[model samples]
Target chain A: MSVFIIRRLLQSVLVLVVMSMLVFAGVYAVGNPIDILISPDATQADRDATIRAMGLDRPMWLQYAYFVKNALAADLGKSFAFNVPAIELILERMPATLELASCAMLMAVVIGLPLGLYAGLKPKSFAGKTIMTLSIFGFSLPTFWIGLMLIMIFAVFLGVLPSNGRGATALLLGIPVSFLTWDGLRHLALPAFTLALLNIALIIRLVRSGTQEALLMDYVKFARAKGLSDARIIGVHVLKNIMIPIVTVIALQFGSVIAFAVVTETIFAWPGMGKLLIDSINVLDRPVIVAYLLIIVTLFIFINLLVDIAYSLLDPRVRLGESDS
Target chain B: MSQQPALSTATPVLQVSGLETHFAARNGIVKPVNGVSFSVSRGKIMGLVGESGSGKSMTGYSIMGLIDAPGKVVGGSILLDGREVRGLDAESLRALRGNRIAMIFQDPMMTLNPVLRIDTQMVEAIQAHEDVGRHAALDRCRAALAQVGIASPDQRLKSYPHQFSGGMRQRVAIAIAILLKPDVIIADEPTTALDVTIQGQILAEMQKLCRESGTALIWITHDLSVIAGLADQVCVMYAGRIVERGSVDDVLDSTAHPYTLGLLNSVPSRNPRGQRLRQIPGMTPSLLNLAPGCPFRERCAHATRECLEDPLLEPVLGHPTDAASAAHQVSCHHPLQTGIST
Candidate 1:
């Protein structure tokens, strides 16, 4: 298992290197950041000095080499927009995004698992069919639109929930977390629900299909014959088998939720990495963009590794080795 | 073993009569187990022999009340130790199952949850019906595993089903079934997927367990040789109906129903070497929209005009009907004469 983890770590490093090169080249292709860095009416000499100072005057390869050299020392250059280390800027926004994504995932599993299991177990019952039909709406509705609807209903009409921003935070282990405060949770509700909509739908479908298939397995019938209560059978036998796929999908979805929650975050004005990424992109903040992309690549690699470990944990047939027994 | 009183004098552990299980398909209501009846006494093993789609497995499932939706036990009287179990409420049925009655399925690989440890599966089976403490349950599970001929029960119990060989997995399943020491166990071809040597060992273990504990076993299989050796009574099923039933020796030696004869003839060892193996002609008739007659008439070589009417189970000529245990019954328009060799 240690060897497997070590190999995965090495692969993650390779991916981050490739991603760094790609991000640098891709940001370079976009209109120059120097124009936005300095005033529009600045003199040519002023422009030249700023460009040289920022190391933008060098050839793209040399610039990438310097970026890589600094990156190896945990130094992602300063964001042009924020005037702070790009990594530091992203890390500052990380907690909000992580909290929101975690809440969304929690909601997805809490709500989707039972509904999906019911739908799969019955499939033809009226309640089961109704749950499935509602899940379709969760999938089809756009996140931004859902975010707006939730805001209008809870904020505008009901006047119960805060529409935008992280309302309040309490220091938990020296990290500001909104969920600890009622006002902060109220602020979190709209954006988190919007972000969770698609994932809930996906989990419902995955678990439903998985449960339906599992119900037909001889083991399930044997369990029934063993006089196990329906709750025990579904909870233990069915849930364990379906968890392999659910864990993989949910982990990957959680990564995407953190990375691509831009629309919902923007709509709700939630200060997260997604908002930082969007703002950085608009200003052509090359360092921030590169840092963000590399972090996301690393997250995906880490999540994939976690999924493999989870797979082995869930399925006894899967062993963490080159050759499976 | 000391001889006990005749099986007929004492109440059988399980008596199933007119058990009909039907499925609602798009086409029609398919009767898989159409009016089957049999009884097994304590410590006796009754073999239910049939080909694929012959409703043998369905009968076992129906007995366990394990039939799923779109299929149900439409009609039946299942008496477990003289208590009617058929049509019992869900809770009551569940209480009886894995407690007073248990089942072992055909494929051991598929019967056990692959993710669960052997101990977890066995412990849960016992705890499901009883309020036993975990330690007591674990002890029972360990003993059950050892009873099924598994070595080092402590180590084996910690492993998952995948860690064991196919034969060993089946033994685990058997161990779970016998954990509660249920009065009756319906083994649905539990040894069918195993090698001959493993099959033989399992059969011996099951027989020994039954003799020692007085558990009535309903061993369902299509292999006549398995029935010939392991079963005291045999019921040959044809197209959802029992075509022949009697003492195993009587049924194998003087097979009455032509379908039973055909099954015996089709055994590769029974046929002459280098000759085309004898096969019963025609396919099994579909249960959906079946004609009102003997289900095996289409395949029976002796099918005649009188066969158009369904045949009722009746005693074979010269068989002693005085003792129900010794009665040799066949459901056929014309049962083959006694002492007729295939």
Candidate 2:
């Protein structure tokens, strides 16, 4: 098992090496950040000095080598907009995004899994049919559109919650979170729901299919025939089997949940990395774009490793198989 | 035998009478188990033999109350030890399942959860019905494994289903069924997927276990050869109905139903080399398109006008044995008789 993880970590390092090249070349290839960084009225000398200071005057290969070296030391150069290390800026906002994405994930699993399981259990029941029909909107409709509608219903008209922004923040376990207070939670509800809607839809579909397939399996029928209670059959037998796939789907999509939070963050005025990315994109902020790409890509690889670990843990066959290999 | 019928000494461990399980398909209702009836006495193995789609497995499922949506035991009295199981509520039925009545499916993979360890799954099966502690359950689990001829029960229990060979996994499944010494076990072609030698071993182990525990066994299968040496009694099924039933020797030697005769003739036994195996003429009649009369008349060698009407199960006259073996019965308008030529 340790060997498998070490192999995975080494593989991740290899992937990052390839990714560093793409990030350096790709960010430099796009629209110039210098256009937004300095005034148009500035003299050629002033521009030259700024370019030299930022090390843009160096050959592309030399600059890429420097970027790789600094990146290895956990130092992404200063953001063109914020004038702080791009990674520091990312790390500062990381907590908010994590809080929001995880909450949305929590809501997705809590809400979607049960509904899907129930739907699967009684495919012919009216409630099952109703849930299946309603969940389509969770996937088909746009996130920005859903966010506006939620704000309109819960905040503008019903006057029960805040419409935008992450509410008053407090530290929990040394990490600042927006959901500690009632006001914060109220503010969180709509954006999280918006971000969670598609994920909820995806999870529901995944669980429903998983459950339906599991129900037909010989083990399930055998369990039922053995006179296991409906609760135990569904809860222990069915749930345990279905979880491997659901966990895989969730882990594979966690990075996307963070990546796709852009629209949800913008509409709700939530301060997360997604919103930061958009601001950086608009100004053609080179360092911030480069940092975001590298972080998200690295995160993807790490999450895949976690998924493998979780999978083997859930089913010992994988764990034992890994040892043999 | 703990839950054996209190009212009568004659009460069999499982008494399925006029069992009818139907499925509502697009065309119409498909009768998967059409009026199937049989019984297994304590310490006896009753083989339920039929080809695929003959509703053999459906009969087992119906008895276990495991049939789900679109399929239901529409009419039947499945008396497990004289207790009516047909219309029992889910909770009541659940208590009886895995406790007094257990089932083993054809695919051991189907019977065993892939993700669960053998010990965890087996113990859970017991604790689902009984309030036994984990330690007690584990002890019982080890004993059950040892009973099924698995060595190193302790280590095997720690292993997952995938770790065991197909034959060994099935042994674990059988062990689970017998863990609580259930009154009846409905085995649905449990050895069909196994190799010949493994099948023989499992059959021998299963029969021995039933004899030792006085647990009635209903082994559902498509192979007459598998049942030949294992089952004490046999119930031959056709189109969801039991066509011929009797002591295994009596049925095998003096088979009355043409369907049974056709099934036996088709077996690839010591037939002459280069000769085609004799087969029944037609496919199994579609349940939806079935006519009013005999299901096998189309394939039977001797079909008469009398066969157009459904035949009631009649006592077979010539068992030529002890009075107990004379309980043989066949459902046919023209059962092979003393004077009648095929």
User: In CAPRI terms, where does candidate 2 land?
Assistant: medium
- Report the CAPRI category for model 1: high
**What TM-score would you give candidate 1 relative to the actual structure?**
0.97
Best by lDDT: 1
Tell me each candidate's i-RMS in Å.
0.7, 1.1
Q: Please give the distance, in angstroms, between residue A311's alpha carbon in candidate 2 and its true position after superposition.
A: 0.6
State the lDDT of candidate 1 residue by residue for A98-137, as single tens digits.
Answer: 9999999999999999889989988999998998999999
What DockQ does every candidate get?
A: 0.89, 0.79
**lDDT (Cα, 0-100) at A30 in candidate 2:** 86
Report the C-alpha lDDT of model 1 over B1-342, residue by residue, as the tens digit. Answer: 122345452588799999999999998999999999999999999999999999999999898888887899999799877778999899988987888789998898899999998888989998898788999999988888888889999999899998989999999998888887888899999998999999999999999999889999999999999999999999999888998999987899888899999889888999989999999998899989788889998898889999999999988886545565357899999888865575
On TM-score, the leading prediction is 1
Q: Which stretches of candidate 2 lie over 4 Å from their true place?
A: A320-325, B1-11, B318-322, B338-342
Error of 2 at B11 (Å): 4.3
Scanning candidate 1 chain B in windows of ten residues, the lowest lDDT window is B1-10
